[model samples]
Each structure stands twice: as C-alpha cells, then as structure tokens.
Target: MNRVNQVVKMHLRNKFTWFLVPWAILGANFLINAVIATSLNDGEVVNTGAIASIFIYTLITGTLTLKETFPFAIGLSIRRKDYFFGTALTVLLVNTISGLAITTLSAIEQATDGWYVRLHLFELGFLKDLPFIGIVGINIILLVNLYFIGFTISSLHRRFGSMSMYIFFTAALLIGTITSYTLTHFGLWVEIAHWLANNYMDLFWWMIPMVGVYMIISYGLLRKAAV
Candidate 1:
C-alpha cells in the first residue's frame, strides 16, 4: 500500500473514537425512523433506521474535509488523492458494516421482516439475486466506488482553501436543485420510470463505469493542489 493508503487504513483501524459517528447516526436515525415507522406499518418500511444510519454517517465523513485540514493530512503524507480515497474507503466500509449492523439491530414486529437485502451497496436491495458470491462482489465493488467518491470530494475547491467549501456546497445544492427540477419537469422520465424504478440496480450499475472516470479526474485534481 502507498503511504497515503496506509495512513488511511491505520486511521480506520484506529476508529475507537470514530464510534462517535455511528452513535450520532443512531440518534438521528431513531428520530427519523420513529416518525416513519409510526406512519408506515410495513416492517421493511419501519425498519429503515439501519439504512438511515449509514446515510447519515457517509454525509458526515464525506463532508469532513470541507474544512481545511491540510496540516493533518500533510503530516501523514496523505496526498489529496489518498485522503479522499481513504475517506471514501472508510465511508464505504463503515456504511456497509453499519448497514449490516443496523439491519440486524432493527426491531421489527414480524419474524422475517427486514430491509437489509440490498445486493448493490448504493441501491437499497441491489444484490437480491446472487446468494453468496453476489453479495461479496457487490460489497467489494461498493468499497471501491466509495473510496472514489471520498477522493473526488476531497480534491475539490482546495485552492480557495478557506470558505470555498461553503461556496462549493452552496453551488452544488443550487445546481442539484435546478437539475432535479429540470429533469423532473422535462420529459426525461416519460418512458423508463417504471423500468428504472423496478430494476433500480441498473441505475447503480452505472456507477461501475463512472468509477474509472472519477478516479482519473480526482488524480488530476490533486496533482498539484495542496490540501
């Protein structure tokens, strides 16, 4: 492993303090899922707190570097590329583990009710087919992409180095809102909505192809940038 990767792995291994993340996530998830479960009696619907926990954790870790912590990463010889990769790997690992834990921890009324059957990491139940090997493959691939996502987020807007993150986040929200509104209003989903929704795995599979693109772009982004 490279120095950056090693540093990150160690940080992940030393996650005694990082347990705070999951605790916070658990608190948030209970609040959110309590309302959801009360309204929806379905076991899967009510037991969504596990999924909620992972989502909350990722959002927090992914945005951690938005604050300038160059001194921290630099001392560890963690390149910008490495930092995000490590962070993403950490997020994916944490989420996947957290996902399983949440699924197991969920308190359902019925004996066999659960929402932790996602075959693909991104989609809720992407890996419902493969039995054993399929689950393993999906997990491995997810870890890779999450590392890539972490890398991508880490390398961006480091030059402004200060409040650029606020700007970046604001701009991202603005762009996302406009794009979502446009796509929803436009006839973008006229035909494939059902197919896409029913076979949502297809949507997440697109990430498999996009991973390479993100890695390459992230590398160039962190090439000369100080983070």
Candidate 2:
C-alpha cells in the first residue's frame, strides 16, 4: 500500500504533465472559440465541442505515463502491481477533479448564458438537460475510459513492440470500417442514433466494464514488461 502511494507521488512529481498541460490546452481552445462565437450574429449558438480537448489530452497523457514513469519506478525497486494500482488511483483522482471542474464550468456557462456570447463550449445542448451529477458522472466515465484505452495501448506496445501496435491499429481500422459499412448498408444509423439519444447516459455506464478489462490487460502486460 505504501509502495503504491509512493508510485502515485512519483507520477505527481511531474505536475505539469498530469495537471497543468491539460487545462492550459483547454483554456486556449476555449478562448479561440469564444472569440469566434462573439463575432457571430446574436442568438446564434456556437457548439465548439472544444471541451473534448482536455479528454484527448488525458488520453495522450495515459499513453505517455508508462513510457515516462515505468522505467524509473522499476529502477527504484517498485513492483509492477504497485505501479499499476498507483496509476489507476491517480487516473481516478485526476479525472474526478477534471469532471468536477468541467461540470462547474458548464454551470457557469449556463448561468452566464454561455459566457455572455452564446458559446456552447461546456454546457453542450445534448447534455444540458442532465442533472449536475449525471453530467459529472458521464464526464468522469469518459475521461477514465479514454485514459485506460491509451494505457492499454501503451501496455500492448511495451509487451510486443512497434510491430504489434501497427498490427493492432490496422485491425482496429479494418474492424471500424467494416462496422461502419455494415451499419450504413443496413440503414441502421438512424436507429442507432435514436437509441443513443435515448440511452446516452447508459452508454457511459457501459464503459465501466470495458475499463475493467483495460485495467486487467494493462496489469498483465505490465507484469512482463521490460525496463
């Protein structure tokens, strides 16, 4: 337990990577979008979707975490299991904080009528009707899910090198393409969209199991990863 905490502290030591960078990117994106929104006509709503910048940054951070920290932690005699647990805890804590920050920003956007420019950066229309807790829950789930996805990819690379990653992405691309074609051919897109609209929150909850799977895979790969 103490060792895991140490691992967490070690990661936190690089505070810029885990903390500052994401928000800095988000702030810059928001500023640009806000400027654009202000130039538009009155009553026009701008949905920049710029809020995703932070989540994408979280994904990139996950992929880099193992590469940057694992070797040093191993040299310090940290066990792989402890490192994994520590990383997982850090992910939860960081994303929860991020979720709260986003939710707060969204509330502010609402109160200020989209920062007084009608820029729908955080309080997106699709999510506006959800309760505050629901919004926070969904955001946390999304951030955690993307982080673990990147972590799992990093683990795969660590376990099997560049060739494995190339193969994995190739397969993913092929599968995604085929799935899209099938859905389009069958005209299932409309139905799928309707289903998603009705059960959007439920979809975030479903990611919990996938995150568990990612954790399991990452742990297994980490156990055998070379320093």
Candidate 3:
C-alpha cells in the first residue's frame, strides 16, 4: 500500500501532470471560442465539440504517463503492479477533479448566459438538462474510458513492440469496418440511431465494464512489459 502511494506521488511530483495542463488546454479552447464568438457577432455559438479537446489531451496524457513514467518507476525499484494501480488511481483522481471543474464551469456558463456572450461552449445542449452531479458523473466515466484506452494501447506497445501495436490497430480497424458493413447491410442505421437516442445515458453505464476490460488488458500487458 505504501509503495502504491509512493508511485502515485512519483506521478504527481511534476506539477504540470495534475496542475497545469488540464486548465491550460481548457482555457485555450475557451479563449479561442470566445474570440470567434466575438468576431462573428452572431447569436449563441454552440460548440458541441468544445469538450473534445480536453478529452483528446487526456488520452494523449494517458499514453505519456506510461511511456514517460513507467520506465522511471521501474528504475526506482517499483513493482509493476504497484505502478499500474497507482497510475490508475492517479488517473481517477485527476479526472474526478477535472469532471467537477468542468461541471462547475458548465453551470456557471449557463448562469452567466455563456459568459455574457451567448456562446455555448462547455455548457452543451445534450447535457444542459442533467443535474450537476449527473454531468460530473458522465464526464468522469467518459474521461476514464478514454484514459484507459490510451493506457491499454501504450501497455500493449510496451509488452510487444511497435509492430505489434500496428498489427493491433490494423486488426481493430478491420473489425470495425466489418461491423460497420454488417450494420449497413442490414439497414439498421436508423434503428441503431433510434436505439442510441433512447438509451444514450445507458452508454455511460457501459463505460464501467469497458474500463474494467481496459484495466485487465493493460495490466496483463504491463506485467510482461520491459523498461
């Protein structure tokens, strides 16, 4: 337990890891959107993809956490299991804080009528009706899912090699293409969309099991990974 905590501390030793980058990314996006909104002199500028930038940033950070920190942790005599768990915990903590902040910002954006510019940036429409806690929960779940996807990919690369990573992605693309083709062939596109519309919230629930699967796969790969 102490070792795990130590590993967690090691990741947090750099202030930029947990402190600066998230806000910087979000702030930059908000500033860009605000400027655009001002220039257009239009009505409310709704950015449906406003949150995407931070999510992508988190995904990239997840891979970097392993690529950069895993080697250092291993050199410090840290067990792989401890490092894995500690990284997972750090991701959870960081994303929870991020979720709360974003949720708060969304509420404030609504209260202020989009920072008084009528620019709907973070306070997106799909989530506008959800309660504050619900919004936070959704963000946390989505963030975790994205983080672990990157973590799992990096772990596989560490366990195997660049070639294996390429092969894995190729296989994934093949599978996705086949699935898409099957769905299209059956003409289930509209039905699928309707199903998703009916159960979009349920998608968040699936993230829990997806996160578990990612954890298992990442851990399995990490156990065999070398620095």
Candidate 4:
C-alpha cells in the first residue's frame, strides 16, 4: 500500500505534465473560440467542441506516462503491480477532480449565457440537459476510458515492440473501416444517432467495463515488460 502511494507520488511529482499542460491547452482553446464567437452575429450559438481537447490530452498523457515513468520506476525496485495500481489511482483521482471542474464551468457557462458571447464551449448540446452529477459522471468515465486506451496501447508496445503496434493499429483500422461500411450499407446511421441521443449516458456507463479490460491487459503486459 505504501509502495503504491509512493508510485502515485512519483507520477504527481511532474505537475506540469499531469496538471498544467491540459488546462493550459483548454484555456487557450476556450479563448480562441470565445474570440470567434464574439465576432459572430448576435443570438447565434457557437458550439466549439473545444472542450474535447482536455480529454484528448488525457489520452496523450496516458501513452506518454508509461514510456516516461515505467522504466525509472522499475529501476527503483518498484513492483509492477504496485506501479499499475498507483497509476490507476492517480488517473481516477485526477479525472474525478477534472470532472467536477468541468461541470462547474458548464453551469457557469449556462448561467452567464455562454460568458455573454454565445459561445457554447462547455454547456454544449445534450450535455446541457443532463443533471450536474450525470454530467460529471460522464466526463470522468470518458476521460478514464481514453486514458486507459492510451495506456493499453503503450503497454502493448512495451511488451511486444514496434511490430506489434503496427499490426494492432492496422487491425484496428481495418475493423473500423469494415464497421463503418457495414453501418452505411445498412443505413443504420439515423437509428444509431437516435439511439445515441436517447442513451448517451448509457454509452458512457458501458465504457466502464472496457476500461477494466484495458487495465487488466495493461497490467499483464507491464508485468513482463522489459525495462
């Protein structure tokens, strides 16, 4: 338990990576979108979707976290299991906090009428209709899911090298293409969109299981990974 805490501390030591960078990018994105929204006509709503930058940044950090820290932690005699748990704990804590912050900002955006510029950066579309807790829950789930996705990919690379990554991505691309083709051929896009609109939160909940699977796969790979 102490070892896991130590691992968490080690990762948190790099405050710039875990804290500053994502928020900086999000702030910059917000400012740029705000400026654009201000130039638009009155009553026109601008749904920038720039809020996604933070989540995407989370994914990048997840991939980089293993590459940057795993070797050093291993060299320090940290157990792989402890390191994995510690990393998971760190992400969960961070994402929970992030979720709260985002929800608060969304509320503020709504109250302020998009910061008085009609910019719908945070309170965009369907998310605006959800309750506070629901919004936060979805945000945390989405962030954690993206993080583990990157972590799992990094783990695969660590365990199997470049060739494995190539193969993995190739397979993913092929599968994605086929899925898209099939969906389009069946003309299921309208139905899928309607279903998603009605049960978007359910989709986020479903990601919880996949996040667990990613964690399991990452732990298994990291256990046998070379330093």
Candidate 5:
C-alpha cells in the first residue's frame, strides 16, 4: 500500500507530463479560439473539436507515463502489480480532476455565451445540453477510456515490440474499413446516427466495461513485460 502511494506521488510530483503539459495545450487552444472569436464579427463559431485536444493529450501522457516510469519503478524495486495499480489510480484521479475542471469551464461558457464572444470552445452540442453531473461523467469516461487505450497500447509494445503494434493497428484499420463498408452497404448510417442521438450518454456507460477490459489486458501484458 505504501509503495502504491509512493508510485502515485512520484508521478504526481513530476507534474509536467501528466498535468501541466496537457493543461498548457488546452490553454493554448483556448487562447487561439479567443483570438478567432474576436476576429468574427457576427455569428458564433462552434469549436466542437477544441476540447478533444485535451483528451488526446491525455492519451499521449498515459503512453508516456508507462514508457517513462515503468523502467524507473522497477529499478526502485517496486512490484509490477503495485506499479500497475498505482498507475491506474493516478489515471482515475487525474481524469476526475480534469473532468471537473472542464465541466465547470463548460458551464461558464454556456452561461457567458462563450465568454460573450460567441466562440463555442468547451460547450459542444452533445456536451452543452447535458446536466452538470452528466457532463462530468461523460468527460471522465472519455478520459479513462482514452488513457487506458493508450496504456494498453504501450503495454503491447513493451510485451511484444513494435511489430505487434503495427500489425494490430493494421488489422484494426482493415476491420474498421470492412465494418464501415458493411454498414454503408446496408444504409444503416441514419439508423446509427439516430441511435447515437438517443443514446449517446448510454454509450459513455459502455466505457466502464471497456476500461476494465483495457485494465486487464494492460496488467496481463505488464506482468510479463521487460522493464
């Protein structure tokens, strides 16, 4: 237990990778959006993908967390299971903090009408309509799933080298293409869209199980991983 706490504190103390860098990117995006908003004279510009940068940043951070920390943790005589659990704990804690902060900013954006400049940065259509708790839930779930996916991918690289990663991605791309082709052939786009519209929030719930799956896979790979 103490070792787990130490590991979490070690990552937390680094501050730059898991915390500052990601927020810095978000701040930069906000600044850019603010400037663009000022240039626009009449209407609102919906920056639907602006918040996405932070999530993507989290994925990179997660990958780096394991890639950079696992070796050091092992050198310090930390057990692999403890390190894995600690990393998982850090992911949850960091994502929860980020999710709450984003949710608050999103609420403010809604109330101020995008800082009175009519630039929709944090408030996207899907997110803006959700209640406060719902928004936080969605953000946390998205962050967790993305981080775990990145962590799992890094674990794969650690356990099976770069070739396996390449093959996995190629197969995923092919499978995705085939699935899309099948869906298009059946003209299920509209139905899919409708379902998404009605149950988008429910989809976030699916991330819980998805996260669990990734957690198990990452731990399994890490157990056999070379430091």
Candidate 6:
C-alpha cells in the first residue's frame, strides 16, 4: 500500500487514537451535562456548566502526549511532516465538528435560559447571536490555533506534557473548586468569585499560546516517533 494510504488506513482504524480516549472524553462531557441539567438547579445554563465543559476539554487536550500516541503510527512509513500534518488534520476535523455541536448547544442553552423566548443576551457588549455556521468557522480557527500552540509546547521538551497537565490541574482544582464552592454554597468566596467572574476570559486567553507551543514541540516528537 502507498504510504499515504497506509497513514489514512491507520488513522481510520486506530483504536486508541480515535476510539478510547476521544470517545471517553466526549462521553464524560455528555454525562456531566446530562447530570447538570437533570439533577442540579439552574444547571447547564450557568457558568459552572460551561466551566466543566471547558475544563475537561483543556485537561484532555493538554495532557495528550506525543510519546503515548506515537506508537499508533508504527508501520505506516510516513514522513514526519506527513504524520504531523495528518494527525493535526484529524484533530482539526474533530474540533470543527465539535464547534458545530457546541454552537447548536449554545443556541439551545440561550433559548432555555430565555424561557423559550430566545432572548437576546448582550454579553459585555457582544451579541448573543451565534449562528451555527459562524460558530463552526470560529471553532475551526480556534482548533487550528490551539493545535498549533499545543503542538509547539509539547515539542518543547519530551517530559512536560502530562506532568505539566497534572500539576496545573491539581493546583487549579484545589483553589478554584474551593473558591467556587464558597461562592455558590457558603458565600465566603464571594469576593474572589466576583473578581474571577470579571476576568475569567482573560484567564482563558492566557492558555491559548501554550497549546500552540505544544504543537510545535510535537513536530520533533513526531520525527522521533517516525524513527
């Protein structure tokens, strides 16, 4: 078989890469959102709900190391560039699809929150409208950028991926969850939560560059994996 076809075939059939991890991640999101909607008051439409989706996605994308996934490319005889491009393509494709899904979801969320009247929400001077096609395009750009950043960072050094993910997640979980709990349940962390609510988007922007860094680093990692 031609090398390109082999790579395609491998990608088509790769169990670990396409099945277990991604599906499990998607399933986790589904289950959580379901529980949030059914069990919790003011669920699925709250910032906390959005945070859960965003956080899980961040952790999964951040922690996926090239070392662990390289094995899946074995016997494909593809060049490093070919492998990198192919893998990145798959990720982008998945992300674009996800963006469409999220756009539809956000519309539903808005309608629900608006008491089924589809109220226009002026969020910080931004329009509440998110056309499905527009959001799909936006998500495409987002994933491309994120993949580049993530690849660069992962490629920076071999040992940093999952370890970095673990440390950051743990610290944030400890502090953020406590803060969140206090804000929601006890009102003790109200001040901090208010401050965060005011600047959470700023915080999210801080991580975008890191994803590109990981993708650039993965370029080298892909070479090593090819060898």
> Across residues 1-227, which tens digit of lDDT does each residue of candidate 6 receive?
35545555556575565446655665575556555555545333423333234324533463353455545554444566666666666666666665566556566656566323322221111225545565556555555565565545455434454576677568878999887777689665667778877875565555566556666666666565323
**Per-residue alpha-carbon lDDT of candidate 2 for residues 156-201, written as tens digits (9 for 90 to 100):** 9999999989999999999999999999999999999999999987
- C-alpha root-mean-square deviation, each candidate: 5.8, 1.3, 1.6, 1.3, 1.4, 7.6
**Compared to the true structure, candidate 2 yields what TM-score?**
0.95
Number of clashing pairs per prediction, in order: 6, 0, 0, 0, 0, 21
All candidates: TM-score:
0.60, 0.95, 0.93, 0.96, 0.95, 0.54
Candidate 1 residue lDDT tens string, 3-100: 65675565576464345765665657555656665456544443242544444454455445434344477676766667656655555566566544
Candidate 1: worst-modelled 10 consecutive residues by lDDT: 114-123
Candidate 4's C-alpha runs over 4 A off are: none
Which segments of candidate 3 are over 4 A away from where they belong? none
Residue pairs with backbone atoms closer than 3 Å in model 4 (clashes) = none
Cα-based lDDT at residue 141, candidate 2: 92
* Candidate models: Cα lDDT each: 0.55, 0.92, 0.87, 0.92, 0.89, 0.53
Candidate 5 — what's its lDDT? Answer: 0.89
RMSD of 1: 5.8
How would you encode candidate 4's per-residue C-alpha lDDT over 1-227 as one tens digit per residue?
Answer: 99999999999899999889999999999989888888886779888878989999999998999989999999999999999999999999999998899899999999998999888887757777788998899889999999999999999999999999899999999999999999999999999999988887788889999999999999999999888
